[model samples]
Target: MIETVENRPQPKAAPLVVHVVRQFLPNRGGLEDVVANLARQTLKRGYRVRVVTLDSLFTTPDDKLPALETIDGIEVVRIPWTGSSRYPLAPQVFRHIGDADLIHVHAIDFFFDALAWSRLLHRKPMIVTTHGGFFHTKKFLAIKKVWFRTLTRLSAMAYRRVVCCSASDLNQFIQIVPDGIAIENGADIGKFADAASRRPERRIVTLGRFSVNKRLDHLLDAMTALAKRDAGWHLDILGAESDLDAADVRREIAVRSLEKSVSLMISPDNQTIRDVIAKASLFASASEYEGFGLVALEAMSAGLQPVLNSNEAYRVLAGRHEAIALADFTKPDAAADAIEDAYRKVATEGSALRESLMQAAHAYSWDAVAERYIDLYRSIEITI
Candidate 1:
């Protein structure tokens, strides 16, 4: 039952579309989810899908992933990388992509630039999905800006397509590459569809990486504010290790004296994560940046009210989905008020609100996204 948008004609031969990314599978996050879904959906369309990723997990560098494996009939190749996690160098990428008819690079990092830099050597039709443009953090803003406008723009020229994963990204990058198109990232919305409380209470849940851009500290601050107003307001944090670790989160919770009210589960299994989602009536995030705000949509799919920060992507989403609330996460009290309002709204609307949220989530599934990628891959007209 591989559902795809029809009408687009494919090439006479199946193209081996190789995906080059900084991380995948073992490292669960927005970017990883994007590449995985794209690879899986495209494979079902009869295109050859291959994912080439860095061998080491960014959070736990000491641990290494399998060098080769097959996931959902798609071949995955993991190559070693050296240097900062920000831009780990993996020149070995060229070795694996030799058989690829089209290369899809995710994130504008080391691989994105290097692959384009060495485009002549590989001699493959290439496209890249800009997953937020590396402006996720405030760190080195000036340096990154110069890099984006200069070197990054040059690199982008090598690719036939530059796909921005969010409208915010399109606005930021379109200045450099005017022809770029916005392709919203897809989420596994059914992962927790309508799994929340029957009449959603004051309980909340947040899931993702403990990355710096996630602004977990601000989220804790908001929880602290909410707890002061209603002791019953609890928060369950389900996330993987990233820039922040378990110890850092524990330290934060201890400072707020919220050991009982706030819970943390690092790298929990799917069912376990869903268990928290099942009990939560609200999902909140204090992130200052998101490429496409995929997790918020997933929370909404579970019938949980999303109280997200006023980031560009989130603001755009909230405009489309009225049930979603916006907040100034930098100001904990303001964020707490937004969360309170969301819970109140949930209490009033109940199943009606939940159904609407789930309906909104389905609008961005992988079906149409895969169709677009298929059309782009076939439009290459390059001989294999």
Candidate 2:
């Protein structure tokens, strides 16, 4: 669920801010969680904040919700929306911005980009944070080479600052937009620390939407390869269905005859997530790319060793903390070997690794990260 803080009754000296993201609350994803957490922390700093986002589409559709509603002390304004969840179109976005002192744009949506461009005409300051950019498929890469690059450059002119969630993403963005900042996402260490301590089972876990970029299919293949050697090992896949079809993942498990060894828990709640991580021997992700790998960080905070797929993002993390293991996900056989080694390491040197991971998690706490954002906001305000 989206975390929120009740609007505090403080002296009205703080500036009003409007955060524009493609889709928010009820829409579960890394960007959604970041926006919700930032908003909550911003409220604590005495700012009057509101979110402008698209209405609940396929992923979050239930009963029709109000266009304007209050959640955790912040007002959320939903604009008119159409199209599918992947390609959301929010019309009349400018009309909803109201009298905000600054605008914080999330993702690289054309509608928001156009609005920011318009804001520039009035010397209005806007901050743009590309949430790790879009998943880099061949088609997306082709689009990024031409159309998206031009769009981002033109939009970059409108932003006061461009934020990237990881150094990997910052490197990628600076090729076209030079003034980008890499501020890693923060975690709630206390929440996971409060959960029941890690009770190592041979059980492993990985979480996030079942999307193509996640390389979950490869994860299953690796699990199958490992299970052949160690029948005691098991995997739990938890998260909502996304770009990848859930049925296809199940079919892969069946084809590999790993039905008994792998279990998929779709859309598990927060409490369930804590319980699963608390009992797991390790947390594994076969994702080829990640913004900040928040789930992996949370698992580390809970004292679970992480077995990550080989990628630039995790490589940066691994470089910082050598205990975090990485495997070549493109090769299931090799990935299986890496997972096996990480599992054994947990049994041997688990306590020291757990302490190191907890220290790493504390280095990126929300309290400190929020203060960085507030400081940025104040600095921008001074210049304006």
Question: Candidate 2 residues 232-272, lDDT tens each?
Answer: 88898988777765787788789989999998887787788
Q: What tens-digit string does per-residue lDDT give for candidate 1 at 1-384? A: 553433333334787888999999877898888898898788677777789999989888889889997775668899998999998989888889887888999999998999889988788889999999889998999999999999999999999999998899999999999999878888887678778888668899999999888998999999999999989999999999899899998999999999989999999877888888888899998998898999998888888899999999999998998888999999999999999898989999988998899999999888978788778777874444
lDDT at position 282, candidate 1: 93
- For candidate 2, what is the lDDT? 0.78
lDDT of each: 0.88, 0.78
Say which candidate scores most in TM-score.
Answer: 1
TM-score of each: 0.95, 0.92
Cα RMSD (Å) between model 1 and the true structure?
3.4
Candidate 1: deviation at residue 165, Å?
0.6
Total clashes, candidate 2?
A: 1
Model 2, position 188, has a per-residue lDDT of: 67
